[model samples]
Target: MEPTRLNKYLVDAGVCSRREADRLMEEGRITVDGRRAVLGQKVTGNEKIFVDRKPVKKPESIERVYIAYHKPVGIICTSDPKAKDNIIEAVNYPDGRIFHIGRLDVASSGLILLTNDGDIVNAILRAEGQHEKEYIVKVDKDITDEMVTSLRNGVHIGDDRPTLPAKIMKMGARMFSITIVEGRNRQIRRMCEAVGLNVESLKRIRVMGIKLDDIPPGKWRFLTEQETSALKAALV
Candidate 1:
């Protein structure tokens, strides 16, 4: 095999993303041929590579898997096996290792994407992609025009910058649907708090062009060919 960057190799081996691989290297958990690996190191795929003392296979051609899951509330969006409510254990995918594309807070439930192809992770999560994620949220109080206008305009949510303009539609007295391009930590909830409302429930309904549809909470399904193609195309 041709020489490849260590981080890329780890990603192709399904150990983790390039960013996570870098973290492992920094923590002195990655080694090559009994020597600690360094960031940006390259290998020809012929050397023994180990991550945290476990041997990693050379990058090989493998079938890629994409799945859409209706993540249930309380399931943590982390791949760490030690985490009590990790999403990976909840899915119990029998095929091979996979990681979530983005995160949904433990208090929220909804559509989340998972895949074995590490190459697409950054593409989907990059802010430059401006991929839209839609959610149905219920606040503790009645919806107000001022709140809707503020959300549609933009609201400061304790971030370095205010959130980008969002698409808002009041669904009922206390229920509304919102669409946002940026995914920040507890963003929707923080936005509500910034506007003097408390989020009672938040559920993502769509990610890009993929929808949760009828997938039962805690259950998952493979992405259709059409959905996969459209998603990749949007990343471009």
Candidate 2:
């Protein structure tokens, strides 16, 4: 077989997405035939591969799984079994190993995607993909015109660059809905903080066209065939 990029190989094996595979390589958590894997390396599917010391199965052997989960507050979005309140334990998916597509802070809750298909994960999270994620946020004080303007115009959230302009609508005195294309660490909270607001509560309600509708907190459901088809079509 032709050699494959290590990242792509990992993605095909259901280990992680290409970006995550790169991070794992940088962190020295991936080994190729007992040697630390190098960024951008390629493998022929013959050499032994391990991620964090666990042997990785061949790509062809992986069975893809995808599901939408309504994460509740206090459930951490991590696969590490050692972490307290880890999402893996909370979901206890019976099929097989799966990882979250993105993250919601422990204090926040709502729609999250879990999957063993790293290709889809990579497509949805691609920086240029600009996939929309909608959230309902409640702040400590009343929403204001100035706050709306600043957020809609984009705010510097201590990152190298200011956040992209977001779609915002005031839903109530202390609540509003926001749609953003980028996913930064605690981005919505930090954006609010930048505009002199404090988030009292946050919940994601949608990703692209996937709605959190009727998925009670702490519950999940597999994506319908139509929903999955539409999502992949959008990515294409």
Candidate 3:
């Protein structure tokens, strides 16, 4: 392999995006040939590289893969082989390694983006409020008007930070649909709890323009070019 930028190498390794790789390098967690790695340092993909003390190997070549998966409840969204029931195992893609773009709790299910394109992962996530994720949540009981108002108005969540006002619509006596731009861990559950509601179930159906559609739980398919383009456009 020819010499490659350190950040690009990290991205190709499925560890993180170029920007994040730069951050890691700056933090002194990355090294090349037993020395601390510097930003923009180049590697021939043959020299010893380590991230946080663990050896790093660049994949021979990575196929840019993007999939919209219908994650089932109980499947963890991690790359850990020991997880046993991780999203990667659930999808069982025979191609190269891919990582979840974001996360869904083990108890929740629905649409989750899986991809090997580290660039897209960083772009979408770092874009912050630029994209929206939609979910339908069912609470333990019917919600009260006051609770609805508070939830709609935004509430202090687990992080003790105020949530962004979300577009929420009541779908049934005990269910509602919410669209939020932030991807805080268990944000929906925390938001509901702040308003005195218990989340009985949570399932995401959309992220930006991509929809789960009729894809059965535990199954996945490659995104159409149009869908892929739409997703990339959101990053810009």
Candidate 4:
């Protein structure tokens, strides 16, 4: 194998993110061939590596891990510079860098998908005209039967195209559920507001065939082998 950037090698091997690996190097925690390596160094497969005096393994040899986090309402789905208390901080995955498959807003939460497999992220997020997300929303006031019918058929929520026909289930006088294939920013909240309902709470309980079930708020678990395949299949 050819050489690669030191940080990329370390991140791919599950040691840390590329940025965190850079910190480890700056702190004199990484070495190449028994000599302390500096920032931005590249390492070939032929070189020996150490981190904190222990050998560093090759990146391609590591297995990836995926997780399902039942994110709480306050967390955002991101790994950007401003992502304090976001999904990345919430799970604190100790191995390879895992990122959310799509995103959930800061005020809406449940079943956020995390994966180190970058391909899966693209598969789930960018697949045009494929897959769907389902959310259960509670509002502060009752919705008239007429309003429910309006949302089901379509409403002008400042979008050029009418929303795809949604599956709306009336749960109570002030509660209902909607399933949508294409996601837009604050799509659910805006959809409700368009018909004069104030969204009091929003929780995504299902994505395709996966359900949030008993997963607690603010914690995460690995996707079962079956779940991984099912999730990928759903995107098709």
List the global CA lDDT of all models.
Answer: 0.88, 0.90, 0.86, 0.78
* lDDT value, residue 210 of candidate 4: 74
Q: Model 3 off-target regions past 4 Å?
A: 1-7, 13-42, 46-60
- Number of clashing residue pairs, candidate 3: 0
Residue range 99-149, candidate 1, lDDT tens digits: 898899999999999987777886775644288899999999988899999
Which sections of candidate 4 miss by over 4 Å? 1-59
**Global CA lDDT computed for model 3:** 0.86
Q: Which stretches of candidate 1 lie over 4 Å from their true place?
A: 52-55, 127-129
Candidate 2, superposed: residue stretches over 4 Å from native:
23-41, 47-55
> TM-score of the candidate numbered 4?
0.76
Clashes (backbone N, CA, C under 3 Å), per candidate, total 0, 0, 0, 0
**TM-score for all models, in order of appearance:** 0.92, 0.87, 0.82, 0.76
lDDT of 2 by residue, 1-236 (tens): 79999999988888877887898899898999999999989999999999878899998888787899999999999876668999988988886567898899999999999988988888777744278999999999988899999999899999999999899999999999999998889999999999889999999999989999999999999999898898889988
Candidate 2 structure lDDT = 0.90
lDDT of 4 by residue, 1-236 (tens): 67788887776665555655777789888889888889889887678888767676676776888787898988877664355776776788886456677778889988887777655665665674467688989998888998888888877789897777788999998989888887888888888989998898999988777788899998777778898788777766
Could you tell me the C-alpha RMSD of candidate 2 in Å?
2.4
Which candidate number would show the highest TM-score if scored against the true structure?
Answer: 1
Model 4 weakest 10-residue run by lDDT: 120-129
Clashing residue pairs found in predicted model 3: none
Please list the Cα RMSD from the true structure of every candidate, rounded to 1 decimal place. Answer: 1.8, 2.4, 3.9, 5.5
